[model samples]
Target: MERLHHHKVLTTVTWLLSIIISIYYTFEKPHDGVWPRRKIWHQNDKFHTAFRLNSIIASIYWIVLFVLQGGYIAHLFSGTVEHVNAACSVGSHFIVNNLFHFAFVMLFVRSYFGWAELFIILNFFNLSSLYFRHPGYARFIHTPVVSGPLAWTFIAIYWNGAIMVPHPDTLVARIFGNIFIWSILVYGLFFIVVYKDYTMGFNLSVLSAAIGVSQFLRQVVAFQWIFAFVIMAVLFVATLVVAVPAATGRDIKFARARAGDTERAPLLGEN
Candidate 1:
């Protein structure tokens, strides 16, 4: 309960925990997969340095955003904001649920990251319950803006952070993780697009506002259960179809190299 009052604390903690989790995923190979035998972190020195510098910039960006959007967070917890009857408009309920889910998303990123259904569900009810406060611009501040790319971007750096999925060995985990990973990935793209925009204006706040219209399209207009399911299925199958052959191809190349089966030398006349 005390945690609700300190959103900044929540932000910092989430980022810090994510950083630790990333370290594990980056260096330690899991038993379930082929472990990398080389020291890869040092392989790309230039990119590594760039990543560190940009990570700092990303940190500064979040601190500034937390300050600017601090008030909207109050609406989420104040509990006194008028609550609307979701039954009146099921669409409104959908809008508010998505908004709240996305709005506090950074704070709740771990929930989605771990595929925590109860956590996500509770958050949806809590955020939507408060957001529809009878209804207006106040609601927009919740999901489309907060859960939108601009605000939800705090975790973009770790979009591939879901390392603890249902485990690849199980069919259900494979399908579930694949679909869940693919769904959240739509938001991951926001980071790349918005970061590109950052190159133009060099301003984080500007990027946030710039993302508004796009968020409206994604959150309010186009995204639906059926649409998401179709995309999820495609991504799932594509991952399997592409990954299986790719892995096999790599294995074949390694075997051929070991066997000294080099590409046939061109004949004297074929040069």
Candidate 2:
């Protein structure tokens, strides 16, 4: 109990510090620079085709799971027979409700923090405590987040290299742009070396690659529901024949009605 209280107090302090740092970075002068213009993967038609296809594959992957999940939910209501539909709905969940999670995570990291933020916030508390412990440690905290790697990311990603060129007319703009491009590579290398979180790291890398392609190629956003639906329809049929991962599962407690009726429930089964 005491340990839990200690953790809660420390958590509160970290959150306070993160909020302060986040606000400062938000309105502060834009120090982020842009990568120089170059041939990115998006410039090639092959890449767009691939991305579209992935989106289609991922979308179909979600849709199938959605319908199946609904049916599974219905099955769960049946006390005797627990019909399971073990399809994975992760792809759908991501592109729909979780789409905002991705954008807010990378674009405005403070809003989308998860385990990453917890680590960063803890650093904030440790540094703050350290500063208080020392008599003359205030000076170093001019940039408090620099006290740790996780917190340093806010500065590294935002202050070091920008996604867009801030000032095209200025003389130093070109210099900054060149620096920004190189800095991104350096940052990615640093992250890969330090943090081995494949899922988050891989997703961010893909996002960077996509940004590079779209920015360079001047890709326009177009609404193509029909195109997506067509791709989904095709994949749905293929899913029946192909061995794919199960989409989901659930648990429902029930009282026994008779003897010799023992059946273990599967996690991915639905109504």
For residues 1-271, write the lDDT of model 2, one tens digit per residue: 4653443344334434433443444345223434221211111222232122232222233343334334433332334332211111111221222222223223333222233343434433443343233212111111121122222332224322232223342446534433444443444344333322122223223333433443334334422222223333333333322212222111222222233322222111222
Residue lDDT tens for model 1, 10-51? 543443453344344335433342332221122111121101
For model 1, what is the alpha-carbon lDDT of residue 52?
A: 16
Candidate RMSDs in Å, in order, are 23.9, 18.2
Given candidate 1, what's the lDDT at residue 105?
A: 35
lDDT of 2: 0.30
Q: What TM-score should be assigned to candidate 2?
A: 0.26
